[model samples]
Target: MAAARESLLDAAGAALARRPWPAVRMVEVAAAAGVSRQTLYNEFGGKDGLARALVRRAADGYLAGVERALAGNGGDWERLTAVAEWTAAAAQEDALVRALLTGCWSERLPAPPRGPAPVPAQRRPEPPLPSPPDLVRIVRDRAVTALSGPGTAPAATVELARSCELVVRLALSCVTAPPGEGGIAGLIRTAAPRTAL
Candidate 1:
């Protein structure tokens, strides 16, 4: 069943790459996945439900990358820079990641403007999984636990955790709006306080 669901998601992703989600019909996704329309409905309930699942899966991938970057050998700041770079680059490449990072529905679909005055509310994409800010907090909390050593002072640990949160937030901000000059590394250095570390 899980394999079937994954196959369907893969099919949906391919279809999304070719065109907008609004144009992706259930029958077509079913055909691409070699599954019946009823099976697709049973697996995902409907199109919106499938959209939520796809976003959730993509968010999970982003979080996994964060964990890997944080766990890598280096000082906290170095790990954060790695995370920032990864997120910035990934946002540019992955539509789902960009949607979650930017909180923009348009990134999840193909372009050229659809319909009349405004797009429908139901068609707009929602980050049904963890938002970028939430992901930052999760990374911050994990960093606190990992960075707290046997002899580390409690005050220092608190400061380190706050630093982690700030760096992660800065990275996310870069992902959302992308600075004209400074880039992720430079942005991280400038945003991090002199006292924070």
Candidate 2:
């Protein structure tokens, strides 16, 4: 079952890579994966479910990249800098990541009409909103684990977490920025630690 789920996800990603999200249909995905539509439905409920899974998978991959960057052999400050650069590069390079960041195709589908809806009014309390990623938590955990060697300072840990938040925001901004403007590298340089020499 897990193998089938993974195969469906892989097929969906491949289809997404070839074209925009609107072009990706469940029938095509099932055919690509050599599975029935029922199997895809069972694994991922529907298109929205698949999209959420894709976004979650992309988030996990991005966090892993951040972890690798934070593991570089350097002081906490340098590791944080590396993480900023790596995150910017990853967001800029990945198509799936770009889609997630930019919200492409997400606005095309209108919300279901409210009139004569299937459920009774009493039973239809507002659905819970999806929470944004806990990027700060992820980064802080990675920084603490990677930089907690003998000489690491407590202040440095806080600084790394602060820097991670700034860097991640800047990376996301770059993804959504206009094409002609300078990129996150400029933002990172502006926010870079000052040297006292």
Candidate 3:
């Protein structure tokens, strides 16, 4: 069942890449995934439900990468640098990720629907999609958790969170204007000194 859901999402995403969401057909998506149309309706109540799931999947995948970046071996700044680089690269490669980070959903993409729909017990509702600032806060908080060593003082934790937010915002800046020569890593080094961060 999980496999079918993933396949359906993969098919939907591929279709979205080629054409706008308004043109995406439920039956075609089902056929592409090798599932029956009835199965598609069963998994996700309808197209809107699928859109919510697809958007949620994108957010989850990006955050998972963030976890990986934060967990990478190195000093705290180095981990933050990994996160910045990951953010830049991901926003460049995947439109859904870019939208999730920047909060700019073009008409071509399915604007995440306004509300949630009830689902089967197996399908838990993803938390509400974050605003752009909320996403930044989420990343910053996660980084702090991953980077803060045990027995760290509250004051130091607050400082670490500030560093995390700075690095994340810098990465987001690079997403729009892009960096000059050294790219995200260089920009991060300039903004985040290893001594303080």
Q: List clash counts for every candidate, in order.
A: 0, 0, 0
Residue pairs in candidate 3 whose N, alpha carbon or C atoms collide under 3 angstroms = none
The positional error of residue 93 in candidate 2, measured at the CA in angstroms, is 2.6
Winning model by lDDT: 3
Candidate 3: tens digits of C-alpha lDDT, residues 166-188: 99999999888899989888888
Specify the highest-TM-score model's number. Answer: 3
TM accuracy, model 3: 0.94
Clashing pairs in 1: none
How does residue 170 of candidate 3 score in lDDT?
Answer: 97
The lDDT of each candidate is 0.74, 0.63, 0.88
The residue-level lDDT of candidate 3 at 150 comes to 95
Instruction: State the TM-score for model 2.
Output: 0.67
Error of 1 at 82 (Å): 1.2
RMSDs, each prediction? 6.7, 6.8, 1.5
How many pairs in model 3 have backbone atoms within 3 A of each other, for residues 3 or more apart or on separate chains, i.e. clashes?
0
